[model samples]
Structures are given as structure tokens and as C-alpha cells.
Target: MVVLFLATSFFCVGQAAKDRFKDWAQTPPMGWNSWDCYGPTVQEHEVKANADYMASHLKDYGWDYVVVDIRWFVENTKRHGYNQIDPRYVLDAYGRYMPATNRFPSASDGSGFKALADYVHQKGLKFGIHIMRGIPTEAVKRKLPIKGTDGITADQVYTTENQCKWLKDNYTIVADKPGAQEYYDSIFELYAEWGVDFVKIDDLSAPIYHEDEINLIRKAIDKCGRPIVLSTSPGATPVTAGPHVSEHANMWRMVNDVWDHWRHLDHLIGVSQDWFSYIKPGTWPDCDMIPLGRLSIRGERGDDRMTSLTKDEQYTLMTFFTIFRSPLMFGGDLPSNDDFTLSLLTNKEVLKMHAESSQVRSLYYDEDKTAITSKNENEDWTYLALFNLSDSAPSDVWVNLSDMGMEGPVKISNMWTNEVLGTVKGKFTQNLAPHASGLYKIEKD
Candidate 1:
């Protein structure tokens, strides 16, 4: 895969749908997704409970979208397939997926999700669903009747090569095909009528092919006459396609399923440094989610143990994620949360840096093992985030104001605690808490 970092100035053609993305995901969406936390086993009741919790607690901080992840089909719901039950329950004869009857009995009239979404909306929240990026395998095998705008079939709109790996079935939509737009338009139309505000299309980057189908999906959302925020998943959304995808997608994942582990965070941090340039307002580079607190489900294959990170390490991770402007999606179950976790998620000061700052860059670092310093652009005071990822070292990192295109003594204030520390010379240094961070505001004094 060729990864290219285009300068932010390069203009990509095609306007985003209905200007829906105008402010759709300006500060990176913060919400709950079922896949990472609950896997394919999430029932409608469990989802409603989670949504209820999010509405009551996390809404004040802007965590609104409640997404129902994969395996919602009826054919995939059968007990024999392990994870692949009846795909029919997830999707239906009309090519529309609804909540399973066993899980959501009200869905027999194609109104299960309709009721759920209504409830979510009544609570001042949004509803979303996930879908693999291809025609159903069963649909293709049975040559199911298609619902094309021009009376064409879905089979005519897609090809077999776009199938997802690790899954037994699904054909990728041929975005360039004659009826592709009409086919995509059909799905979004169903969703729009059902009141969906977000849709995550998966298997999108398998072998990372097809910019045409991507464009078609974007177009479908627009024609639906609804503002559906589109998110592409399991991104290794190649950097070569970054510029184009940034414009079309409100937010996209930057890695495979992120679990609650140290190595995952370590790897994600390194990969994101190269993505800083793509951190514009509407488009965000997602680092999966905060897998801390209480996550007890599949894909979260850890000791249902409490987060192993020390306070310092947790702060360091949160600081890096917030300053880098990654979407602050929490993966832990919201209904049962500790005060410590809530405090971290609801910190207004930390979130302010993520929402407001436009420019972020690495300012200084000694040997890679010792320390690293990052800078954020704040109109009033320049913000600095210093972290030490090393296991055994107390990182001593410094920043020189003059070198950063600034002058004079720098007055510093802690961004987290809001304590104004005294002034420093052109060069100022801080001893980092091991596996921790020091987020500071520097002003010209």
C-alpha cells in the first residue's frame, strides 16, 4: 500500500453531500459503538440500556451518536454459525436491515429501529447503524430481486471481487457500474426514512480499492435528503487516499479494532504523528476508542480486569489523544462507570484544546527513549504537551520559544489543573512524570 501525505493545500474535487458534513463531525465524534465493546451479540434491549445511559450522562459532553454495529442480520442470527448467524435479521428481503425480531420484536413491521431511533431522538440523541460494504452473499447467490431506481438489481450494480476477507460472504458494490448510484441511493433512502443520522460502511478498504464506490455512497447519502454522517471502517484508509477521503468522510478509523492494550496505543501514537496534517475541522483521524474503564465483551479479549494503566499513563494517553484532536469515543460500558473515568472524559479544559486548537506538531525530543514534546496552537496562549512513553525514564524535555517563532520569557500555565506557573527563559524545561504528560500553556512575557 502506498502511503502519501499530501500537503493540506491540494484541492480535491466534488462537493460533500448536502453540506451535511459542514459541521457534521467538526470536533471528532464522541460516542459508543457496539462492535468493540459488545461484538455481534448485542441485543436491542442492551443497546437501549446503553443509549439510555449515554443520554442521561454523557450527553452534556456531546457524546450523542449510538451506533449498532455488525451482525444485525437474521440469517446470521442462527446459533450454529458461531459469530455468523442469519444475516436476514440484520438485513431483510427489501435489502434493508432492521433490529432482529427476537432481539427487537417490534421490528416485524420494519419498525424496530424506527421505534428505537425515535426514542433516542426524543432523548436529544442520534442513531446510527453499521453495514459491510458489499451486496449480501445470499442476495447474490439467490439472485435476489434488486430495488434499483431504474428497476435494476443489486447484482447488476456490484461485482464479486470486492468481498470482505475474514467473512464468508458479501460482494463489494461496483461504484463505477451503471446502476451503482441507484443501488447505494436505495440503502440510504431506507435509512433516511428510518431516521438514521449516521452510517458506518465496512469492508470499504479491503485491499483498499474503489474510490468510485466511495463517491457513490457519498452521493447516495446526499440524494436521500438526509444529513447522514458517513464513516469508513477498519481504516488503513491508505494515506495515498487521505486527501480525497478526508473531504468525503466526517471521521474514519486509523487502525484495526483497537483493544485495551499498551502496544496498541503505542503503535497508534506513532502512526498518528504522520496524520496530524489531516486534522481539519470536519474531518478527523480517529484512533479507535478509549478502552479503559469497564469493557467486558468480545474483541475486548482482556482479563475483564480494570485498566492496567497508572494514573500518569492514563493522563498521558488522554492528553496525547485530546491534543492530537482524535475523536474521543469511549469504548467502556457507560451505564457502569467509575468517577475517575467520568472525570477524565468530562474534563472541559482538556476537551477545549481538542475542539479549538488548529495546529499541532512535535516541538522537541531527545533520544526516542527519553522524551518528546508536542505543541498546540491556542490564540491566547500556545499549548505544549510533553510525554514520556519510556517505561523507566523520567523524561526531561524542553521547548525554546525563539525556535518556535516566538520571543521573550514564556509564562506557563497548566492546562489540566489551570495553575499558572511562573515565567521561564527563552528555554524552559519540565521533568515529566514517568509514563505521563505535562500539558502547559506558554505566553510571551
Candidate 2:
């Protein structure tokens, strides 16, 4: 039966084919994630600090989620990579890892993340956590019982075959096994009770695609009776699996771990070209986290610093991310944002295009420049993005009005700088610095 279900493709037209969880994030989710700056070592106070900052300054701009990323259950975690210490994790009797109260004191006495989630809820924001794909290795090693199953154990429901090569935290759950589904159900149930609004399942889509496990998780969330938004990540999720992933997940990463480096930024543009066709209202092709503002306070990479991208490149970063319509998971210490970085986050016009635009597509590209175009579905206007990818020299970037579904005598206003360049008849042209970009709104005069 699992085989039959896995073989089914969820492709259909009309109302019923829409994902039930689609409404949970009609537009791509804008939020902060702890991974790029805090890695696996984010403390409760730090999480609360970011939440308070977001609630006060960013919630009105559509930034809502405050996500704790990776290994919140482990103690003595390293700033770079992980510390493989003896008896590293705190776990319950069921072999499921629990938050290390040393870091998240609010999780003490088996309360889990309830107190922290409640704090964020009271401040009018959502809470999310990151988890590895499978059952904890400690659980199987200790032979812990699987909840919601009669006389079934974690060891019985898992295998080591095809496990994550880099992260050795968990073993693969054998979905056909009697208690495997129950194990997934059990974890999500606990998360629901803890008031988790979002979940990012790591190592689920990359290197290898675990369709069975994803299906099991999808069912568990549905059965858990919460409107929990699911995000599957750490990929390059294969385009061949697009149909299944789009139907199953709210967002899936199209690239892995983008950081504050030019190479990483450039690679994102190249990689993102392949994913433009896959974006839809509910299912987003993630561009990973936006590595802006201050980062690496306790990260897996580099020392503490503000983002290295120059002002022009930062414009390029925000321009492509919004015009491409990727879920904006800002990766920085929120309270630490400088004025320029804060400006990037609060651009209402650019964000509006990100949320409401449809038919977004890559128009043309070459060694020096690329053009992207889209339309606002609700207000019925056109949007265009021009990017310069040269090494050092500025270049003139132009887009023909006809190619963007607009004719002559139309206004082309720069959405980022809010400058209207009067009316254009045949074409729009602007010279951009190397690695800079412009986002424009085009409408008939």
C-alpha cells in the first residue's frame, strides 16, 4: 500500500487539486531562522530577543516566524560543526530528544517549548523548529518505545540504510514497519501540543529523496489536527520530484546554505534559473536563508561580522529574492541590524511584488546580465528585474516593453529606490554597477 501511494502523482486541475495546507501560506513566508548566525546553539533568550525585535519592528512588514534551528536538544554544541560528546543529548523515556533546558530554560520539567511558543504567540508571531529527518539514533540504541503503538519499539521501525551522510543524528525510519508511521505521528503530536506553527525537516529532500518518509510525515501533520506549515529542505530537491514535493511541502529549498559571499550569491542566480518554472501560490522554491545583517555569532562558518555584500550587491540580493518570490527567511541577529540592513527588510513596494506577483519568469540571461519579469495578479501591473553580473564594470541593462507584455508610453518606476523614470515608448534602460540590480513596476500611462 505504501508503494502504491508513493507511485501516485498528485497532479490535478481545479479546486480539489489545491493543497489543503495552501491557505497556511498563500504568499511565501517571511521570517527569521537561527541557523546562519546561531547554528545549533541558539539560546532561549536570544530567540526571545529576536522575536521581540520582529514583533516591534517587522511584523507589520509581513515578517512573522521566529524559528529555532537544529539540535536544540544537544548540549556542549560547537560554534563550528558539532561536538560529538558522550551523552550529548537530553531525551525523554520514549527516546525522543528534548530541549536542553540549560539553553532553553522554559522547556524545563517536560513543558517542552510551550512557554516559549506562548511568548511568541502573545507577541503576535509564529514559532517554528528544525528537526532532522528520522528517529534519533539514541532512541533506537536505547530501544525506546514508540508512542501510539502497542508493544512496538523504535529499533523495530528503523534502518541505517540510506541515512544522512553528513549528519549522524538519526536513522532512517522504515515506513512500512508497524510503528514507523506512529513515531512520526508521535513527534508532530508533541509539536502541536507545544504550539509549533511551522516545522523545517532537514535532510529530507537533499542528496536523496525519501518519498515514503515525506508521505508519512504529511499524513502525521494532517492527523495531528493542527494547521502546522511544513517546510522540507537542505537541497537541490530534484526537479523530477517537483510534482510530489509541491503537493506535499509548503516550501522546499532549491539551493543549500547560501551565505554572505559573492560566490554563493552568484551560484544562487545560476541555480535559481532552473527553479523559476516551479513557483506557485502555495508551494515556494526556497532560495535558502537571506544571509544579511550581522551573522556568525555562534555559527558553523566564519567569525562575527556584518554581511560582506556591498550596497549594490545587497540590492541585487533583495531584488532577486523578492522578484523571484522565494520565502524570505532572514538569517541574522535581528536586534543587531544596521540601518542599511533594516532598510532592506522594510521595503514595502518590493515586498508587495514578492507577495502578490504571478507569472514570474526569467526573460533572458548571459555572461554579464539577466532579466526577469512578472505581473501583479491582483492589481494587474507588470514587474521587471534587471541584474548586472559583471566582475567590475557597470553595464547598461535594457528590457523591451513588448517582451514584458506592455506597450509604449508606460511608466517604469524603480521599486527599490521609488524613482519614476517618466514614460517610455519602446524600451527601458538603466546602467547598473557590477552585481547590482533594479526592480521596476511598469504600468500604462
Candidate 3:
């Protein structure tokens, strides 16, 4: 009888957690983030411009979610720069950071992000924001009151020892402290009231593995009475923590920031292999954002320019992310995207692989090449990607049909080119360019 009660209690807890976030992110999210292009200084007009572009051009292709990434509350952020010390961040009486009215004009008059969120919603897209994972250092120093609590203040729950190594703007919350959970709850409650659809919490995921804080945030999200997709960032997330993270977040980064560099792209192949088994319906092991087209305009990185990735490498990057079923967050400036980048972003067949494919696995990998395969849920279509990791001349990249559990005479269509390359048996091969890829859909002939 004791064992039976334990089993029932465990099942009830699991079901409740699952049910709470079930309606959020039914599949991997496809969206654009402001980080790579505008960095911490993205303004209201810039955000709306991107949303307008997505709604008018890319929404039909399943691209949505315009996320304002990082430090939207720091006043005079453009002049101070992102990582520099600034004493003028906008914060409320409860010590929670609020949008800087000068930057996000719509947030003036206590409106917060509601007006901007409504604008995004009207554009037929979802809105998201990036946040550091703890109480602002300024708040703790000022001993600001914790909302929804009688006597608790920010200092009571914050710990300097647990702060983010790279960013010192915030102090990590001590999960065991008296007002810790209340602080998280109050912030998420405000976010819910602001109609936030997604929140990407940074500095709390991966290497830190702040399980207690994560759970508190999860509880806060659940009690907020809204469906907000949670994404954790700056990964190299420990594979062993997959179960815990999957239970708490809709998406979690699998690598550190991914840029257009070939080395970064190559690194993702291995990261994807390690985390492939962790992916399920609602939770995704993110490969970070696709940094293509015009990037780093006003960002922390280098000067504004088109992506340094060659055209072939660009195709390979998209194919890799799509077949792996990673959440696609384009990091380029949308308005400045050229024809080639636009074509890549708007490909229906490639997006299909991201949305519908499952059971993705790396069939093989080496210094020169990598092969991955997946199948649609119905099992009617099979997707395969062969990447040339080498910088040597283009050569035959082949995958044996038997490895894919398929036998001969199959019709193959190149997803990128949308060209039907007649029936083949035993093995399929393509003469891919150096650092290029061939993505194909295979079917029994």
C-alpha cells in the first residue's frame, strides 16, 4: 500500500508539471532575436520594424517571435554600452527591472511592455524578452522591497557569490532565503500581466546548473496564470541534466553563442549529437541563433556587414539546424537581408524538416564529413543531410541506404534546390562543395 501511494503521488506530480506547459511551444519555436543585430540597445521602432517585416514577409513561412534581447532597462544604454557600469537602469519599487522609457517609449506611464506586446500580437507574432536570472545588483544595494511580501527586501534573497561570471549587473538569488521564491514570483507575475509570451533567462543554465533557482522560476512561471515559453541560454548544458532541464524549460541552449564562423558551425555538429536524445515534443536543445545576412550593425561584436559565411556554408548551417530540429532564431537584421538570405529563410521544405521531423540522429561524423537523418512523424518521408566539414576540394559525400533502414530505388529530392534527382539504389551520393551540405528527402520508389 505504501508503494502504491508513492507511485500515484509521483505520477500526479509528473502529470501536473507536464500539463502546465503542455500548451506552450507544441513544436520548436521559429523566430528572430535582436541580439546579434542590435544587441542591448534595440529600441521600440527597431523592434516594430522587424516585427512588421516578419509579419509581412516571413510569418507565412512559420517565422514569428520577435525577441528583444538583453538590457532593455538600462537608461542611456546606447552611450554606456552593454557591459559597462550604468547606475541609471529603470526599476520599480519592488526592485524588478522595467523597460527604460527613453528606449521603449511605449513602456512609459507604467505601461511596461504591454503596448509593445500588443503591437507584436497585432502583427500576428509572439513577443519575447531576455532577462538575467536574478535580482539586479542595484536593487540589492538599495535594499528595495520585495513585492507581495511585508518586510522582505532584495538583499535578503540575493547572494553575491552566485553571480554571473561575465555580467555583474545582477546577483544570483539564494534559493533557500526567505523571500527568494517571492521575488521570482513577483517578476513572472508582472511579466504575465505584461502579456509576455516567452522569456529567455540567461546566466542560470548550463555550466552553472542552478537547479534550485530553476525550480523556483518554473514554479513562478506556472503560477503566473499564462502560457510563457521558457528558454535557457549560454549553454554547453550538461547532457546529464537533460531530464531536469527538459522538465522545466521549453528550450535550452546546447552550445555557447554560435556565429557565422566555420569553426562555430563545425562545433555545433558534435553538440547536436550529444543532445539529440534529449529532445522531445516541447523541449528543444537549441543550437543558438542563425547569424546570417546583415549582422552586428549596432551589436557588441564587430562592424556591420553581411555574414562572413560563404553561400555554401550558409546552406550547410541552415540544413544542419533544420535536420537537428533546433529552434531557429535568426540573428540578422531583418530589414537589411538580401535576396539570398531571404530565400534561405523562406524555404518551405526546409522549415518542414524543422517542424515535422523527429528521431533525428547523426548517422556518422568525422573530420571531413558528417551525416544526419530524420523522418516525419507519419514515417512517409525521410530526411538526410550530408555535410562536408573539410576545407579541401569538393568530393563525393555518400550515405549507404542500408544505414537509413531503407532498400534501393528511392526517389530523392534536394530540399534546398527543390530539384528531383531521379531514383537511386544501394547508396546516394552528392558532389558537395567544401564546407557545403546536401539536404534531401527520400521516399521508396
Candidate 4:
């Protein structure tokens, strides 16, 4: 896919709904998702515990959301992967997937996620849910009535074309079919009732670019009467469809599931570089989650343990994500975070750069090294990110101050450590450990 570097309008015709809620995510959203630790079987208590952790610790530094990831409606979820074999799904009379009360016990009364959402909201944080993009196949089989429709139903509006292959839960909603928009509208309407603050819709981006359904969902959200942040996932989100997704979704994945490994982190450097131009205030190109702290307790990929990434590499993970201004969704179990991991999330200076910096762009990229730069329009300092892509040996990464729109003597301080690394002129260089990175602020002295 060809990456286009263009600054275009995020809105198109028939986007009256988008115009109102477009400002909901003015900066990259920082939150915690349950998928990294609990897979699909995250219990209501687990969700509340994470929320409690976020509220007590991370909320002051902008980490607010506590999201329940995929398969909340599955009554029997398995670990190490999905419960593809005899997975029991729960659906409401209206055919909307409801939280499996066996898993989310608060929904035993059929309140769905309302009680959990209220629990999260009471913590001064937000709540989000993961959903597959389409109508539940069971809903179609049951021929459930599409809410707010004149006897229209789920089976009438869905199509088998381009249906999600890996997960057999839902059928793709036909863009122009009758009740299609209502199907989406009804779901978001339910989410609004549950007081959902964010929704990450999967199978709607990448390999199959579901722009029409995205529009339907966008319209659904606009009509829901809530400022729900929309996120599209499992990307490499067809680089050419940037503007369309930008208009409809607040955070669309730029790469597939990024694991806690060196290569995965290495791969995102390029994806972020390719998506650099699209980093506007409201629309962010997500680079997946931060698989740090304690991960894979009962996750889809691995056995229970902390992340496999080493300390230096973890810094690169935080450094690049912050400077690139991608949404920081911590994928680990928050309550289990160690002192070192907690330190990564609490640094005010690094997060300030993530939230405030503008004009973010790659200064250069190559096999051995990569450099990225940004500026806060409100401040005089220029922020820079330098990474050593090399795996084994220490390497020197270099960039010219002139390229960063700076010249002459300038004081450079490490944003992570806040240690002044002295002054430099037009040419500057920093030696980084293998797989390590650095964040610095350059200001004219």
C-alpha cells in the first residue's frame, strides 16, 4: 500500500454526526485494555481492579480508560487463544451481543456493561469495549428485530461477503442494505445506554477496508447522543484510506497486534513514520498497545509473565510511542506493575511531549538508525527521538539541527531522565545502545 503524506480535511459529505463529536479525542488517548492480560475472559472484578489501579495511580498523568477487550459476550472463554470450539455467546432479545453474565456478573440482571461502566466512571476515568464490526450471526439466525426500525431485522441487512474469517461471531453489514445503518445505530445506542466512552471496532480495517461500515458506525455514534471515541483495529489500515478512516474513527491501528518483542517494536518505527503526516489533533494513527508491566496472565498469545522485552528496548518502546504521539494503551495488568514499569508511565515531561508536541515528522530512517522530531508550538524547544534499530551492537545515530529547523548552539536535555546532555550546533550525534532509544529536547541557548 502506498503511503500518502497529505494534510486534508477529515470530514466528507453526509458527516453531520462527525462534525459534533470530532473533538472528543483532541490528543492521543492513554488507557489500559484488558486483552493483554486476561484475553477474552476478563471478569467484571478484574475490570474493576484495573480501573481502581488506574484511578489511584495513573489517572493524574492522563491514563484514564479501562477497556474490556474482545469476547465479553462469550460465556465460555479459553486461554492461550480464542474459544473457537463450542464458544457460548450471549445475545439480547434485540440481537445485540450482551456481556455474558457468567463472565461479567454485574450483567446478571441484564444491565449489560452499565454497572461496570458506572464503576469506572465513578473513578473519574472512562470505560471502553472491543467489538467486531458486523451484526452477530446468531442475531441474524434468530431474526431479531433491528431496534428503531419498522419491522426490519439483522438477517435482512447483513452480507456474507468479506466476513471476518478468524472469528465466526458476526456477518458483515451491507453498506446500502435496509436496516444496515440501523443495526449499527442500535448497537451504539445500546453502548450509549451503557455509558461507553470508547469503542474499538475490529475486522473493519486492514486486509479488508470497511469504509462503508465505518461510515455507518460513525453515523451511529453521532446519533447515539454520546461522545464515544471510535477506534478501528488490526491494521496496516490500507494506507490509502487514511482520510476516510480519519473522518470516521478517532484511533485506527497502523499495524497489527504488536507483541512484547524487539521485532514488533522495530516494525512500528516504519509504520509510525509512514503515518506521520496523519497525526492531527482528533485523529491518531494507533501503533497498538504497550505490552509492558505484567502481560499474558491469561492472554491470547503467551503464558503468564511480565513482558519479554528488555529494559533498554522498553525505553525505546516508550520513547518512540510518545514522540510519535500514538495513543498509549497499556496492554499489561496495571495493578501488577513494578516500580520500573510504573516509572515509564508517570514521567510528566515525556507525556507532555506526547500530548503537546506538533509538526511531528521523521527526520531520517534507515537500517542502523532512525530519527524523529517534533515541536510544541507553544514552547521554544524542539523534541527529538533517536533509536538504534541495530539488535546486537551499540551504534551512533546522527541528525542535523538544521533539518530539525534549528541551528547554532543549543542545549539538549534528555526528556526521559531530564539530564542536560550539554550544547550542540548544526551537527549532532548520540550513541545509543543496541535496541535502545533516547528522547531529548533541543532549545537554543
Per-prediction TM-score to the true structure, in the order listed: 0.87, 0.95, 0.96, 0.96
Candidate 3 local lDDT, 346-410, one digit each (tens): 99899888888888988998889889999985869899999999998997889999999888689
Candidate 3, poorest ten consecutive residues by summed lDDT: 78-87
Q: Which stretches of candidate 4 lie over 4 Å from their true place?
A: 1-17
Candidate 4 lDDT over 1-445, as tens digits, reads 1233222232433354345566899999999999999888799989999999999999999999988999999999988888787888899888999999988888877899999999999999999999999999899988999988899988899889898988989999888988988888899999999999999999988788988888899889988988999999989898899988888789899888999988988888877777988998889999899999898888898899999999998999999889999999999999999999999999999999999999999988987799999998788879998999997899889898889877689999998889999988988888989998889998889
What is the Å distance of residue 311 in model 3 from its true position? Answer: 0.4
Local accuracy by lDDT, each model:
0.71, 0.90, 0.89, 0.90
lDDT of 2: 0.90
Candidate 1, residues 1-445, lDDT tens digits: the string is 1233343223232323234564777667777877655666667777788899988888887789888877766534422123544344355664555567776655677665788788889989899888877677666665555666555665676676746766654777776777667767777888888899888887775367457777888778878888788888876677877887887788777777666666676677777766878888888887876877777554325534456767776787788788788877677777767888878888777777777776676664443322233344446657677776666777676666666666767788887788989988777677885577788777777
Residues 1-445 of candidate 2 have per-residue lDDT tens digits of: 8766655643333334346777788999999999989988999999999999999999999999999999999977878888765548888887777899999999999999999999999999999999999999999988999999998999999999998988788999998999999999999999999999999999988899899999999989988888888899898888889899999899998878899987887888888888888889888999899999999999988989888888888889999999999999999999999888999999999989998999989999887899999998778789999999998898999988888767658977988789988889887898988998888898879
Query: What's the CA error at residue 374 for candidate 1, in Å?
Result: 8.3
lDDT of 1 at 154: 58
Candidate 2, poorest ten consecutive residues by summed lDDT: 9-18
Candidates 2 and 3 compared: the better one by lDDT is 2
Please give the distance, in angstroms, between residue 374's alpha carbon in candidate 2 and its true position after superposition: 0.9
